[model samples]
Target: MEQPVHHFSELFEQLGLPSDAASIERFISRNSPLPPNMSLSEAPCWNEGQAELLREAVQEDADWAEVVDHLDASMHKQQ
Candidate 1:
């Protein structure tokens, strides 16, 4: 069986975003705590390609699932 990679940098790369420390921190802070009631797919922060990759990662239970799930939850948390 194939093992899933659980690295945050891996997830960032999969999403076509920068995986460097500063870039990762900036991405998380900018996109998280998304607008109230906004789903991950509905967040205005993601480009179409990024959003599609995220949706696939969550729905497919892919290697990036854990990070994507965390992101989804974090984005939905109440302000």
Candidate 2:
């Protein structure tokens, strides 16, 4: 019983964000270089609901976790 894999666009959609490639890239560029001390869920960019969803995805290691981790890394990358 393998868990379903999720993509970045799907995760963005789940979070009620723009899921298109260009929009996703713009979002990452705008909000990226996340401070080394900060977690994705702790970023000021997220609302309460979005934060909770991010927290759960990581904590529970859900199908969304991989993409979430990818997002975390992407945000942390220096522009």
Candidate 3:
């Protein structure tokens, strides 16, 4: 079965950002290139904190893993 697609707003909060919709949109738009063609773990746009959080989420298959994985795949798709 396919997993449900949650809003990126939750992810913004998880990454220690404001969880507002407009802010989320702005962040994604501003973080262009998103380190195109690179792995999410190695994406240059992520700050040290953001990268570490993502790494933990993905590596541990945490509750946020699905969202983080979705983001990783989406980032590549947009490239």
Candidate 4:
């Protein structure tokens, strides 16, 4: 398996996200799925709520709500 190269702290530092790296990492790790479909695509106009949805959907283990949420949020943010 291809492992993530950096630690969560390093990743957060690079991105300058407001959320704590440990919390984010814990959330991600707990929610992780197999057959990895995880990918995040950003939009310039994306709102925080929308971005959150997109982030959730990209996780390999996301539920149906996450998928629909991402779609709805992305559309709302764009419009």
Candidate 5:
């Protein structure tokens, strides 16, 4: 069976965040360059539930992992 594919907006929606393209861009811009030593799930921007969901997605390598990783990469990018 194939795992479901996920998108950045879907990941954001899953985390109860604004999922529009512009909102996602603004969010990434505001929070980009996450500390090199920090994990996305540990970012202060996330609520406990959101953080847990991120952690689980990564730890389990779930269907959400691709988009989660994308978000992490986007945040770590230099402006």
Candidate 6:
């Protein structure tokens, strides 16, 4: 279940910049490290590491349950 890759084309359009892979990568890596135990749904507040890891987990193209387990962002302790 490969997730469709996300591009920042629309964001670039809105912000009026020429967005590309390098641009997106630079933008992401520019962020600060995030803390563990923080809710990812409230990301940007999350450390850069956590946010990037979460993004990787998502882009891995696994099932949602598998992604949750890997990222440990489960809504339930066990579900």
Q: Tell me the whole-model lDDT of each prediction, alpha carbons only.
A: 0.78, 0.95, 0.75, 0.43, 0.92, 0.43
Ranking by TM-score: 2, 5, 1, 3, 6, 4
Question: Which portions of model 2 miss their true places by more than 4 Å?
Answer: none
Q: Per-residue lDDT tens digits of candidate 6, residues 1-79?
A: 6654433444333334446757644544453233455454345534565455555545664333253343233222232
Position 42, candidate 4: lDDT: 51
Candidate 3 local Cα displacement, residue 9, angstroms? 1.8
**Comparing 1 and 6 by TM-score, which wins?**
1
Superposed on all Cα atoms, the candidates' RMSDs to the truth, in angstroms, are 2.2, 0.6, 3.5, 12.5, 0.6, 10.7
lDDT of 3 at 14: 70
Please give, for residues 1-79, the per-residue lDDT of candidate 3 as tens digits: 6655556778878788888977766666666446565768787777899999989988987778888887776666563
Summarize candidate 5's per-residue lDDT along 1-79 as a digit string, tens digits: 9999988899989989999999999998998789888999999889999999999999999999999999998888888
Question: Candidate 4's residue-wise lDDT over 1-79, tens digit each?
Answer: 6434443344334334434756654534443332223334354434576456546645654443444344334333322
> Top lDDT: which candidate number?
2
Error of 5 at 64 (Å): 0.3
What's the CA error at residue 23 for candidate 6, in Å? 1.6
- Could you give me the TM-score of model 6 versus the true structure? 0.30
Pairs clashing in candidate 2?
Answer: none
Q: Judged by TM-score relative to the true structure, which candidate is superior, 1 or 3?
A: 1
Question: Alpha-carbon error at 73 in model 1, in Å?
Answer: 3.4
TM-score of candidate 5 on Cα atoms, chains taken together? 0.96
Residue by residue across 42-71, what tens digits does model 1's lDDT show? 788888998888888878878777888877
Measure candidate 5: CA RMSD: 0.6
Q: What's the C-alpha lDDT at position 58 in model 5?
A: 94
lDDT of 6 at 71: 29
